[model samples]
Structure formats: C-alpha cells, structure tokens
Target: MKVIIAEKPSVAKNIADALKIKSKKDGYFEGEGYFITWAFGHLLQLYDAKDYDSKMARWKMENFPFIPEQFQYKVKSDPRNRDRQDGGAAKQLRTIKSLIKKREVDGIISACDFDREGQIIGDTIIENINAGKRVYRLLLNEWTPNAILQGLNQLKSNEELLPLRNAGVSRQWADWVIGINLTSAATLKFQKGKGQALNIGRVLLPTLKIIYDRDKEIENFKPEKFFKLAALFRTKDGKEYEGFYTEGKEDKFKTKEYLDNISGQLNGAPAIVDDKTTEKKRELPPYLFNLSNLQGYITSKYKGWTSSKVLKTAQSLYEKKYITYPRTASNVLDDSLTGKAAKVLEVMKKGLPFEEEVRFRKSKRVFNSAKVDSHSAIMPTYLVPKSLTRDEAIVYEAVKNRFIMQFMPAAEHEETKIITKLRNADMKGFFVSKGRVQLTEGWKKVENIKSKEALLPSVNVNDEVETVKNKVSSHETKPPKPHTEKTLLKVMETCGRSYNEEDTTAEAMEAVLSGFSIGTPATRAETIKKLTDTGYISALGKNLQCTDLGRRLVETFPVKELFDLEFTGRLEKSLADIEKQKFDKERFLQLIYQFTKEAVQQIKTGEDVIIHEIASSKRSTEVLGKCPVCGNGVIEGFKGFGCSNWKNGCKFVVWKNDKFLATLRKKPTKTMVKQLLTKGSANVKGLTSKKGNKFNAILKYEKNPENDYFSWKMEFDKKF
Candidate 1:
C-alpha cells in the first residue's frame, strides 16, 4: 500500500474519487491499496524567532539582526491565539505521519499542487515526521478524474524536486529574515505608538512604493488649458460627418483665441477631400486567460470585483474541474497539450451559436512550447460544470468563451481616413475624419460585441463638400487617473513597465518571462490584499490610493533599496534562477542575510523620526473627554479617539474596531468613549455574548497593570 498526501481536503477527496476509493477514515480516506490524507494548506511553518532562542522572545534593540544557525519547523500556531498550536493542523499532521509509518506502506506520493510552495508544504511535513519510505510526486494542473489518474500513473521521484525545494526554502528564509529584523527595527526606531507596526517585507515595500509614487504624481500634477477646432462637413449628397481640424499633425492649440479665429473662417466654407485612404485590418482574440490577465479583465469590467476575488473564483472552478490551473503565469498552452485542447474545444462548442465557426487548428499564437512555463494557460477542462454560483458562472463563462474564441476566425474590419481641406478659407490646415466598419464578426460573435465606430459619408478624393458648422472646444488637460486594481496588477506583473494588452510579440513575451515581476501571478493578488489589510493602501471605489501612513513611510523610510522596483525584481529573478538551478540557493540567501543586517543597522542608527504622526489639522479640536490614563484631553482622530498626550507615552486610546468590543458586536463610538472616560463606565446596549445572545451592559476600559495595555471589562445590572 502507498500513502498519498494532498494539499487540502477537497483535493484529497477528488483524488480518492478518481482512484475509486470509497472507504472513509478519520482525517483521510483508505482503500484500493492507498491511504489518502490531506493538509489544511500548510500543516507546518518555520519556527519563530523565540523558538530559536528564548532570549529573542521579547524584541529588544540589542538582539539586532538575529539569524538562526539552522531553521526548524513546528505545527502552525492558532490564528486567534498564537501561543498554542492549531488543533486541526496538529491532528492532521498526526494522521499523515501515522499513514506514512504504516507497515504495509512501501512508498509515499505527494499529491500537492505543482508549485514551489506546494513542494515545500509537503516536503516539510514529510521531513518533520522523519519518514524513510520512498517518495514520489504527482503533478497535475487540473483536478479532473482523467488528469489525476494519469498523474498517479506517471509520478516523479521526490529526488527530482531538489531545485524546487531549494527555491522555496530560499524564498521562505529570506522573507523571514528581512521581515522580522526590519519590521522590529523600524518599529523601534520610528513608530510612536502601539498596535501599528511598520510592516516591512521583500514584496510589500515595492508594491507599496508603486502606489505611493502614483499618489505623489497625482498630488503634484498641474493642469493646463487647451483648445481644438471641430467642423461639421456635408458631402454633395447631403451626408454629414464631423471632423477635427489639424495643423501639421497637431490638433490641440495652447490658446483658445487662435483656434477661435480659425473656427470663424471655416463656417459655410467650401471644402474638398484632399486625400482618402481605406485599409483592411484583422484583430486576433486576446491570449488565453493567465491568472493576472483574468484578474485584470474581471476586475476592470465588473463593479465591486477585486483581483483577489477573481482568483478565488477561478481557483474554485479549477478545483471543480471546470478549468485548468488558474494560478499559472504563462498565457499560452504547451505544444504537448494540443490533442487534449482540441478534444476540450470540440466538447465546448457543441451547442454554441458559433459552433460552425469554431474549428480547431494548430496556431503558434495559442500553443507554443517556448512560451509555456511549469503550467499552461488557464482554459476550461473537458468536464463542464452543470451548475455553479452566480459568481462562478461569471468567471466560468469568461474562461469558456475565451477558449472558444481562440479557435474561431480572426475579427476583420475596414478603417477609412479622410483629409478634407478648406478651399476658400485662408487657414493652412485640414480637417480629418476617421471611421471603422466591421467586415466580419468572426470571433467577436462569441461575445455579441458588435463593432461600434463612426460611419463616414461616401466621398472620394477631390470631392467638394460644405463645412456647415465649426466650433472651438476648450479643454483642460486632466491628470493621470489613479491606479485601479487591474492597472496596478499589470504594472506588478510587468515589473513597473507599461505594455499594451494587445501586444503579444515575442519581445513582449520575453519581458513577461524575464522573471523580473514584483510577484508571481499566484501571489500578486494576495500582496495587494495584504497592503489594504495592513492599512498601507486603501481602495476608494476601484482606485487604489496610498494612505497617509503609506505615503509617509515611502518618504521617510531610510532603506530606499527596499522601495526600489528594480531591486525587488532582481531578487525575484534570483529566486526564479534558483528554481532553474542556474543560481545557488546558498549564495542568494547569504546576500539576503547581508542586506537584512545592513537594513536593520541603518534603521537602528539613523536619525530618529516618527512615521505615524497625529494629523492635528484633521482631528477635531473640541475635546471629546479626558484621557483615562494621562488625564489629558481626548480628541477624535481619523481612526479613533485618542489622548492628546500620546507623545508622552500614554497609550490610552479607544480604537474604532477595538477587539474586545468587536467580540461583543460593538464598536466604541464618540458618545460611548466620552461617557466611559468621564464616568468610569458606559452603558452599552445590544452587546452580544459568545453564544450570540444580545443584552445591555456597562463597559469600562482600564489599563492592565501586568502588561500596561488596556483591557475592557463588562458589567451587567442583571443576568438573563
């Protein structure tokens, strides 16, 4: 018998179903000479600083740049209470370990996701248990039954995954070293109060810098006024169209008076078509859905949808066998998948309206071995889901339609450009009119998006026409728009360089595959979500703007390299090289260690500064009440009601989302804080209990003598 460990319970269940194993056991399934177990993503995590040395438990300045000789692993800690191990993770790890040690088991197969993180997750658990059985790895992009069975039949030895393991380990250790040392040092050096630690990470700083720089650009933008002349022209046959007047390829004028004088001369003026050109153009459908492109398409087209939400939805479809891997970076399929892709296309186009047009043929645009990486682009699997949630349906149809459109003919259109000259006027410019007409719907029929373009009147070169109307339109140059999640993800995926979405040249593909991006497609969404969660950036109706804290950190943080996009991209490229065995893991990690030590030292010895300053201009001057700890005036700031004497080390503040109050389904309001500060306690109604029972109670905020931190105490007049 052999044991199989999957990344999650859903995956293990899928594997068991594929293998026809029906017997269910605690924390795993058993049958068909196999015991299939699963982990809740990661069953183990690297040891904390305190685990390496008890003296490092309390972060102190003297314990600077602490590096462990040998890293160790432990069961993941409970999220709610970090002091204890998670019960579920511990129980599952025990289950996996027992299965590995079973006398009947001859070999173990790791059925985790095929990626660096997945390799490490399974490897760490197996190594932690000291399992001596021969090990194999099952790699499959989709969780379909056929894919699973085929993967199990062709498993690779665990020894072949050393490069991936090295890369994963290097990334993990480097992040820990940089995160722990720099976060602690920055907090101690610059942060003035508790609860908000300066979050410094290898990926977080660069991503934050992207938003901070954009925000700064907007803040300093200067708007300028401009004008343009437009004319309404009529052909001899009375057909009408509008054209913009251009002078030597320049349509915009710095002064409105100049365009106004020109506009006055063109009214009712005789015009002749000086030149006319028509060209046929063909536009191919967009490349297949990679994780980043899918996220960008969905987040930009739909309201209230974020990149994280799109990824989660796509991942669900993949697990359900509706699509291939959704975390892939490659935008094209591998040549080896041609047969499978053709079969899938046949199955998907059976009942579509454009079924006749969907013909499968080998095209380098869709399938190229040189462009593919570890996994192919995301497309629908052969097994189509009969039912899905509304969100799932939206994402599923997108992938399905994109897949079908690839096999259809390219969309064709005719573009016409006409240059008309004012014959009787003294103006030395011409009015240009352009129009597009769809020649063939082709792939566009899949989306029912008919081409909408200006329809020009029938006219030829040297044809006389009358200019009926002319006007000078005044406009002000607008600043660049704020970064939406879609645009931001693009910049992150391309390493801060802008590229046209339609540009799929070999050079563009090379840029994407250069391994210089801020984060992988699998990680960019999570990074953005983390920035928002940590209050470094905020989403204001689809636009990402850096918060005051984020802006200040960018301007004041001493470690400029961390904020540099090129610096972060190079580190990412090094990790990619490590995975390919082109770079040594030890060397990469040593460089990270040196960088972390220097960064921490810079923070500790640099000039003292405060990144988090109470904006007095934004705070209400009317004192809410007296601070319970310092007896100073309490003022309402953006986040909470805090003591005015916060600079004096009095950490008495009632945050809006105080954890203790949140547990009782309550938040500290201005009225509540004022009453509590003056009367020692406040009667808060609608407070909830552990069982979700609601009642009225008196709440008090008092400093704990042991930790010098504030805690909430509740008192009820009568028990229910």
Candidate 2:
C-alpha cells in the first residue's frame, strides 16, 4: 500500500474519488491499496524568533539582526491565539505520521499542488515526520479525474524536486529574516506609539513603493492647457468625415489663439487628398490568462472586484476542475498539451454560434514549450462545469473564452489613414483622418466584442473636398489617474513598469521570462491585500492611493534598497535561478542575511526620525468615554476601543472582534462601545445563538476579578 498527501481536503477527496478509494477514515481516506490524506494549506510554518531563544521574545535593540544558525519548523499556531497550536493542523499531522509508519505502506506519494510552495509544504511535513519510505511526487495542473489518474501513474521520485524545495525554503527563510529584523528595528526606531507596526518584507516594501511613487506623481502633477484644430470635410458625393489639423507630426497647439486663427483660414477652403493608405492588420486575441493578467483583466473590467477576489475565485474554479492551475506565470500552453487542448476546444466549442471558427491548430503562439515554465497557462478542462457561482462563472468564462480564442482565427481589420491638405489656404499643416473597419470579427465572437467601424469615404490621391466646418477645441491636460488594483497588479508583475491592460500579457510574459518581478504570480494578490489590510494603502473606490503613513515611510525609511524595484527584482530572479539549479540556495540566503544585518544596523544607528505619530489631538477630540478600570479617556483605534492612558499600563480595552461577541455573531461597533462605556451595559440587538436563533439582549463587558481580563455578560429583558 502507498500513502498520498494533498494540499487541502477538497483535493484529497478528488484524488480519492479519482482512484476509487472510497473507504473514509479519520483525517484521510483509505482503500484500493492507498491511504490519502490532506493538509489545510500549510500544516507547518518556520519557527518565529522567540522560538529559537526565549530572550528574543521581546523587541529589544540589542537583539537586532538575530539570525538563527539552523532554521526550525513547528506546527502553525492558531490564528486567534498565538500561544496555542492549531488543533486541526496538529491532528492532521499526527494522522499523516501514523499512516506513513504503517507496515503495509511501502511508498509515499506527495499529491500537493505543483509549485515551489507546494513542494516545500509536503516536503517539510515528510521531513518533520522522518519518513523513510520511498517517496514520489504527483504533478497535475487540474484536479479532474483523468488528470489525477494520469499524474499518479507517472509519478516522479521526490528527489527530483529537491531544487524546487530548495528555492521554496530559501524564499521562506529570506522573508522571515527580512521581515522580522527590519519590521522590529524600524518599528522600534521610528514608530512613536503602540498598536501600529512598520511591516517590512522583501516583497512588501517594493510593492508599497510602486503605489507611493504613483501617488506622489499625481500630487505633483500640474495640468497644462492645449488646443487642437479639427475640420468637418464634405466630399463631392456629400460623404462627411472629421479630420484634425496637424503640423508635421504635431497636432496639439500650446495656444488656442493660434489654432483659432488657423481654423478661420480653413473655412470654405478646398482641400486636396495629399495621401491615403489602407493597410490590413490582424490582431490576435490576447495570450491565455496567466494569474497576473487574469487578475488584471477581471479587476479592471468589473466593479467592486479586487485582485485578491479574482485570485480566490480562480483558485476555486481550478480546484473544481473547471480550469487548469490558476497560479501559473506562463501565458502559453506547452507543446505536449496540444492533444489535450484540442480535445478541450472540441468540447467547449460545441453549441456555440462561432463553433466552426474555433478550429484547433498547434500554433506556436498558443503552444510553445520554450515559453512554458513549470505549468501551462490557465485553460478550462475538458469536463465542462454544469454550474458555477456568479464570480466563478465570470472567471470561468474568461478562461474558457480565452482558450477558445486561441483556436479561432485572428481578428482582421482594414486601417485607413487619410491626409488632406488645403489647396488654396495659407495653412502649413494638413488635416489627418484615420479610421478602422473590421474585416472579420474572428476570435472576438467569443466575447461578443463589437468592432466599431469608422468608415472613410472613397477618395483617390489629390481628390478635392470642401472644408465645411472648422473648430478649435481647448482642453486642459488631466493628471494621471490613481492606480487601480488592475494597474497596480500590472506594475508589480512587471517590477514597477506600467503597461496598458490590453498589452499586459505580452509585457508580463517578457518580465517573467527575464526573471524580474516584485512577487510571484501566486503572491502578488496577497501583497496587495496585505498593503490595504495593514493600512499602508487604501482604496478610493477602484483606485489605490498610498495612505499618509505609506508616504512617510517611503520618504523616511532609511533602507532605500528595500524600496528599489531593481533590487527586489534581482532577488526574485535569484530565487528563480535557485529553482533551476543555476544559483545556490545557501548563497542566496547568505546574501539576504547580510542585507538584513546591514538594514537593521541602519535603522538602529541612523538619525532618529519618527514616521508614524499617534495623533493625540485627534484622539482627544474623538474620545468615546472614560475607561471603567483606569478612569482614563477611551478612544477608538484601528483594532479596538482602548484607554488613552495605555502608556501607563492600563489594560482596559474592548477588541473589535472580541471572542465573546463573535460567538454572539456580533462585533463591537463604536455605538455599542460608547453605550457600554457610559452606561456600563449596551442594549444589543439580534445577537445569534449557537442554534441559529437570534434574540435581543443587554450586554456588559466586565473584568474577571481572578484574571483581570475582560469578559462579556448577557442580561435578558424581563419578558424573556
């Protein structure tokens, strides 16, 4: 018998169903000579600084740049209570260990996701258990039954994935070293008050810099005024078109007066066609969706959708076997997948109006092994999903339509450019008219994107036309638009360079091929989410703007290299090289260690500069009420309502997500906090019970006399 482990319970169940292992057991499935188990993402995490040495528990200047001689791992702590181990993760780990040690099991197969992180996740658990059985790795992009069976049949020895494991381990350790040392040092040195932490990471700083720079650019931009001259020309046959006046290659005028004078001269003037050119152009559909491009497309097109949401939805679709792996960087399929892709296209194109056009062909643009890395671009599986949620349907259609477009013909257009010159006027420039007419809506039929036709009248060279109307339009240049999640994701994907949404796939592929990006395709969304959650950036509708704290950190943070895009890109490239065995993991980690040490030193010894201030005046003005225990004023904070005299060791506070309140299906709102502080109890409404029933109750937050910790007590109305 052999044992298999998957990254999550859903995947484990999929594998078991694929293999016909239907006998369910605790924390795993068993049958058909196989025991399949799963982990909740990562069962283990690297040890924190305090774990290595107890003295490192407290943030002290002397403990700066503390690097562990040998890194260690432990079961991840519970998110709610850091001091306690995650019960689920611990129980699952035990289950895996017991199965691995079973005398009947001769081999172990890692069925985790095919990525660096996945490799390490399974590897760490196996290593932690000291499993001596022969190990194999099952690599599959999609969780479909056929794919799972085939992947298991063609498993590679676990040793073959050592390089990927090395890269993953190096990345984890480097992030820990940088994040722990720098965040602690910077927060200690610069932050003036409690609660706020200066979060510094290998990827976070550079990503934050991208938004900060864009925000500053908008703030400093000065709009300029400009004017343009346009004419409405009428052909002899009464065909009409508009043309903008151009002097050489310049169309915009600095002064409206100049364009106004020129507009007066062109009225009623006879114009001769100086040049006319028509060219046929074929626009291929955008390359298949990589994680970054897909996120960019969805976030830019849909309102209220963020990159993080797109990633989650895409991942959900992937796990459901509706699409291939969604966390890939490559935008093209591997040549080996031609047969599979053709079969998929044949199935997906059925019943569609343009099914005839969606013929499969092994084109270099769609299938190029050289362009693919680790995994192919995201494409739907041959198994068409019968149902999906609204968000899932949106992402699924995007991937499905993009795949169908690859097999369809390129969209064709006839681009026409006409240059007309005044035959008798004194103007030195010609009026240029450009238009496009779609010759074929080939791949565009999948998305039902209508091509707007700008038809130009039939005209030959030197054909005469009359300038019937002319106008000089005045305009003021607008400041750059704030960075949206779409644009921000693109900037991160390209290591700080901005690209148009239509061209993001090509540019992002180029950046990925060159081994330069702020974060991996799998982590970019998380980085953006973190920035917002940690208050470094905020969303103004769809636009992302750096917060005041973010701007100050950019301007005042001493370690400029952390904010340098090129530096971060280089480090990212090094990790990629390590995965390919072109760079040594130890050497890469050593460099990170050296950098961390220097950065910590820079923070500790550099000139004292405070970046975040507590805003005492504002806090005083917005005081909720007096603290019950300390008799000091209470104010609302980012996470809770706390006593303003916290510096004096007053522990009287109410967390926003207080556990007792959470059980009642409510979070303490400012209104509730105010009522509680003033009246010693708040009249709460619609609190839910464990049985899914809701009732109104009076709630009070009182200190436990024995423990000196706050707890909530409920009082019912007399009628109840």
Top candidate when judged by lDDT against the true structure: 2
How big is the RMSD of model 1? 9.4
TM-scores for all candidates? 0.86, 0.87
Report residue 643 deviation for candidate 1 (angstroms).
27
The lDDT of each candidate is 0.87, 0.88
Candidate 1 residue-wise lDDT, 553-624, digit = tens: 898999999998889989988988898889999999999999988998889888898997543354467798
lDDT of 2 by residue, 540-617 (tens): 557888889898999999999999999999999898899999999989998999999899989988889899876543
Residue 689 miss distance in model 2 (angstroms):
35
In candidate 2 the C-alpha lDDT for residue 266 amounts to 82
Question: Candidate 1: which stretches are off by over 4 Å?
Answer: 505-507, 613-720
**TM-score for candidate 1, residues paired by index:** 0.86
